[model samples]
Target chain A: MASVETTRSGGDTGLPDLVLRGMTLGYLGWMVVLPIIALGFQSLVAGPQAFLDAVLDPQAVHALKLTVVTALVMVVINVVMGTATAWVLVRYEFPGKKVMNALIDLPFAVPTVVTGLMLVLLYGPSSVLGTILGTYGFSVIYSQPGIVLALLFVSYPFVIRSVQPVLLELDRAEEEAAATMGASGWLTFWRVTLPTLAPAIFTGAALSFGRALGEFGSVILVAGNQPMKTKTTPLYVFGEIESGNKQGAMAVSLVLLALSLGVLISLNLYQRRWSLEDGK
Target chain B: MKTRVQGLAFFFLALGVGLVAGCGGSSGPDASGDVIKLGAYSVVREAFHDALIPAFQEHWKQKTGRVVRFEESYNASGAQARAIASGFDADVAILSHTGDMNQLVEAKRVSPDWAKNPTGGIVTHSVVVIGHREGNPKAIADWSDLAKPGVGVLYPDPKTSGGARWNINAIYGSAYLASKAAGGGTPDLAAVADLLKRVQANVVNMDASGRQSMSSFSERGIGDAVVTYENEILLRKREGKPIEYVVPEATLLIESPAAVVDSSVEKHKNREVATEFLAFLTSVEGQKILASYGFRPVDQTSPLLPEFPKPAKLFTMADLGGWDEVQTAVYGPKGLWTSIFSDQGK
Candidate 1:
């Protein structure tokens, strides 16, 4: 029995496991790490002036501003929708609950390009709904609203998945006790419920915002890639590269990387803080 | 009982390892130096599949006696430039224009001057006014006909697509020519500027696919006209869409350049074979093949194939400041075209 157990140890399979880990690390290094390092080094060679010029360029600045603004709106929408989704899934029992439960995972299964295409089909100028919307001059495909929709499509899953576990783990007895005390549902939700979910919601929104900010493929397809308006930072990075301005491209890339890092760090800190409070 | 379970576990572990090893076998091509990677923009990719690949492979095989293979990545010019700049390797990069090649130069990945590099003589393609609908309902005759009130336009985003830049330049060049034919005696590029702004007002939205722009125009009622490569119009017409071509009295040319990647060839030390592939592109047989694929050949007296349509007003890079200037000026933000037309999106 001891020999059998010992054979299962990582040490016993050291060569293959080490090779597997090395392969994973190498794959990640080529795909992610090496390019980031090269890009960072390239940006550094351009120095501060190029960075400032890229960041302060009116068009890059506008695109970056729009990316942040849309991401914030998406974060708000996702937090509300995702929290409600988690709460309902945790607390409610209804017909088709199992099917409805399966649907939350659908966004994960669906490619974002499909999501953008679906939005275009449903709300674009050609669709039945789109034509009606078009008559009112409410074009959705190539406007600020389209960016919002695309961001929402990509980032929606993050918040729901993030909050569901915390909501499920939450004690029902506390809510019942509040109901017994004659507290109103809204009051109970506000005083007893919100505080517990706030940290999770925050973490999810940060993830959503980070994902939303960096989205390229789907957003560009729908957003018309309008300079100074629909052009997100990734799209801006694309334009800079096309224009033969590698320094400009690298410089803007670093800004996006820095912003993403900031969100990830804050989310990490919030998770740690919330876990400690939960422990106490 | 424990020994039986352990034996079963070990069997499963070996099975898993075997599966991974089998998958790992064919996952990547030979990492040995024998294989050559060629990265290109889209049409060359199609041409390689259709025309160049077999010839190049045969030619390389006859010479080296070792099997030579090419790895290719193809995309729109801007997107591909990003991949190359970020380190996708290519022994050669055959692209639509010199703007993207200049990007590699600007990044110091290539020799400072790509124009001076060994490659030759006019590779031909054409663009024309891809009109509103069958029988030309809008009757868009000249370049200025796009300005007819209530006539919207659909085209690829210029910032993101090389073909769209050619499309933009076509209209702009014609407008400039009209300014000259009026005999004030010079092409006023600014007229191209004004024309673009007015046309910009009518653009419902810019899309990335030239075909998608046409499809959107037809399906979504997105626009009245799309300016795209004439080959695109022919390609689409074959699919049985109701479409017509408007050969504007004035037109700009599309020349697809083929070049060996200086650094990539040096690294691979396959300059002889790489140069042969380019030679194949400029060869009479290659030009003949290009013509078959609907490229209007630059060799005028070489006899016309009956199927291909002749361009009305054929022009080339020599007419527009060439690729270096186009990269610095038009595709560059400070360039007249970008400074003017790009503002509409904002």
Candidate 2:
């Protein structure tokens, strides 16, 4: 009876379990690993020298720079605004609070392409606001600012969703204790609250940054797709494919994949370290 | 008790498998017995959906007393072509230009003799035209006008859009002809490249396809003028959208091609019908349908649509060394477009 129980629960049910593990591994190998491997292989088709040239091309470099710059700006905006929003929803009670909280997730619910269209409708050249801005020689649509705007909308909810739960579970006693010691509100938030919330905030920022890195649909519409000027890496990859240069596309895509994976791994490690410190 | 738990787990697993099996039964190709799969460029969606498909369906039913289904997918012409080449399993492809169709031919999905077919390999035609606001506020008249310093032009990126490739070629072709006529010598490549550079400088938005770029012009009112297919302008005007367009004096006539994907049709055992469908598109009735939808009929025998004004200097892809040469010189790796924008600042 003990042996049967062990086999059923802890010991792996032998042959069937082995088969199931194999199936799961095979499925992932087929779906995820194979495509990435294929891309890597295809990138090497024109030899390593050609692959390097394709990736290091002047236009490719500009696109990468633009993608990174926009994504970083988006991260900054999302982290600040998203944290403030989550803080308000968790700490303060205001009219339409529930609706406001619900609205924060609208970016996640709507398609990315539609987000671009909405931005254009609100900020395009002919709209009242857009016209006003244009009259002042400050264009938003079809520029770097437009790319950042699209990225901000698509990635706004990531940080908020990540930090909300942690904020909810945080103890308020420490803050009250700080207040009793005659600590100012800002001082309490900076010293007592921020340190505790740092890990969650970091985790959320990393997620938003990672998502913004791969943002294509929304940015494609707003970026104006000017080569070397407003074009992003994904758009460049798309252009390469359209021009029948699949090898170039694959090489650039592999670079993006590696960057995203590196960030993800770093984020995990960082979160783990912070959580470990908190335990002590 | 442990055995009972294991037994329950097994029961749930089997139930899940059964449910999955039930859901998957209707998803195979069994139901596609009489379906004609079409993968086409996005710009032709309206014409295909409204007139062409229904007419084809009626024609098939009347001839064979059997109903047929059309499974269609539409996207930018380059994307659609790439999809078919990469095994999207499309039986027919109606693409925007010869470049995309030639991509399929290079992949052997289409026959090499595609150009010599009954349809003249050219299925329907339109010239690149300038679309402006209702009152022609910008007063954009010709290709040269688009390059003016303050003019904001909207066109799709040549990399992803078949239509944009044609538009780019038209601009370059026009410049070449103008230069040739002025000097009475070989067409100057530098002059053509310079014109393209100027036009690119004035471009405010480069969307993925012609339709999307037109939307930026008409809907967002982003650009002062737009370069797009003439038929699109006509189609929009017919829909009561306030748009006016002009046919440049010297413009490239876009020859949109339609062909049967030989391998896909052969694999699906629908080659005869696919060939018949291609033939149908060039038929008198099909040409009429195309004309009604604003496409200049490939069948020149058909009466011309009065709304489609004749350009003083019209040219085909043949006038500019066909798709392969044009693609190589203008849009190939390290081509003219790449060189022109290579030093552009961030």
**Predictions' DockQ, in order:** 0.34, 0.64
lDDT of 1 at B278: 69
Residue A137 of model 1 has an lDDT of: 81
**Residue-by-residue lDDT tens digits, candidate 2, B106-125:** 99999998888766787888
CA lDDT of each prediction against the hidden true structure: 0.74, 0.85
On the 0 to 100 scale, the lDDT of residue B226 in model 2 is 90
Q: TM-score for model 2?
A: 0.87
Q: For every candidate, give the share of true A-B contacts it also has.
A: 0.53, 0.95
Per-model RMSD to reference:
6.6, 5.2
**Per-prediction TM-score to the true structure, in the order listed:** 0.79, 0.87
